[model samples]
Target: MIQPDLVELVALRGAAHDIALHARKPVLARLQGAHRSAQRGRGLEFEEVRLYTPGDDARNIDWRVTARRGQAHTKLFREERERPVWIVADLHVGLYFGSRLQLKSALLLRAAAILAWVATMDGDRLGAVISDANNQVSIFPPRSREAGVLPVLEGLVQAQPKQPGEESFNNLNKLLTTLKPLLQPGSLVLVLSDFSALDDNSETLLANISLHNDIRLIGLVDPLEYTGLPDGSYRAGLPGRLWWLDGNRTRRLWQEKWAARKKYVDDMANRLNLPVIRLDTANPVTEALPQLLREPSWQI
Candidate 1:
């Protein structure tokens, strides 16, 4: 059953979505630098004249060039300032549990909210991929209009978590194969997942994705998940068949689980060459988001 508090988290993420900065690749991606280039369309300002080609448009012909060189000339151009931002969310059932105020699935909504706001704020484009058991892929090409962000949140609200039986047919590897091409050069890719090692294919897809865009991996984990609940007898099973088990006693058996999970997350981050942002399910993303967003993209 969905928790009431979790529903609130989703609503909060939807309400606050729209805090993003315009971004670009550093001018020196090849030489190594701490920033990406923010180049945009060529201004209409007059530039020096160049000889006109056979197919040159007469409208662009420089009268001064024609007069001085006795031949028509034209101006060159740069592309317009339009960047795209693509976001993928993971809501596998594994993320549905929380020992605290919220579950990992609910926390993802917060991250999505921050991303939606940022992507739409700077005249950028937006797209989304929901990596659930269904492996659904919804792509909304980048648009500058104000109406874009809502569709993204709507998609998240409607997304369903993957079930165990579903995983047998649709895994992350097959999912990423479809997702990779959706990203254009310079797009910002944000992945929100509990990131259990479900398949080797997911790793390969991530590696391939890194070749074209900047990727951020957000690890969503609950404190209780890492540290098992204190020993106590809790009813398990339906009605008359119910039985109680010692929760605290079982926790000691896997107390180091969080440490191991951290190592796995770190190892993946290292392989993908991306930064990992760890957040407790109980914590709100807004608390640390501004800092994360403001941090130089080049650093990650």
Candidate 2:
């Protein structure tokens, strides 16, 4: 199969546009429009008219409507601006493996790129935090411009997966801890990862982050990771050195581990009240992404 490249990833802008056209779905609506701020203040758009109450501001009274109906009425307004959107993508060694369409790294990058484009199209500022084994890079919130999505996509293109032995250095929790301060309240935060690296501390930090921000977790996995291998010996490994999986027992154990990891992630996300969308490498991102968006749980 052809490997995904920067050009392909960058083209997700158009894919996002296509997805937005299907706005009957709540998730698509959220992705395609300016996010309504929870706080109502000045500079908001008129939402509706309601019967005036004791505490209603007199200045907000709709005199014409009140005079017509002969009853006091007040205007309600909706926050008119879009909030910043942050994409946090994991580039650890664990994401480098895939048995099908694309590597987990590629899928994560593609998903991030698509969301970045959607956020930009909806008139929101875009930011990103990308982490590998020993390094974390951040692109501060940048106003959406014609080419706003390019920088984040470029970073993904340039990122290299961590070496096998360097897995211990994958400190996603530290990266997230440092990122927490930078996120503005009410911002939308999308974390794309296999989430196999999360520990107790990471879960705590994620929960804390969710308290102030809208957090969505996208879990990337390969078919092999979810389904056990067939009953047979198979050779696998890097170029210089190789190893063999001798029997079905080993495959079952591997599948059990993957299932446990998936459960851990699911349970943690549930505790944090985070919405998670699972993406598989067995299918093309274009196909997999829309399916995820269509899910009822994809809504805020």
What C-alpha lDDT does candidate 2 achieve relative to the native structure?
0.74
Instruction: Give the TM-scores of the predictions, in the order they appear.
Output: 0.71, 0.77
Q: What residue pairs clash in candidate 2, if any at all?
A: none
> Per-residue lDDT tens digits of candidate 1, residues 1-300?
453333543355444443445444455652443223543212233545789999877888888768988877887654434456677777665665667766666677667766776666555667777765465566655665456667667666666452223233344455467678766666777777777753467767888787777778777878776777677777654345677768877676656776786787788788777877777876656776666665665232
Query: lDDT of candidate 1?
Result: 0.64
Candidate 2 vs. true structure, TM-score: 0.77
The weakest ten consecutive residues by lDDT in model 1 span 34-43
- The C-alpha RMSD of each candidate to the native structure, in angstroms, is 7.3, 8.0
Full-model lDDT for every candidate: 0.64, 0.74
Q: How many residue pairs in model 1 have overlapping backbones?
A: 14
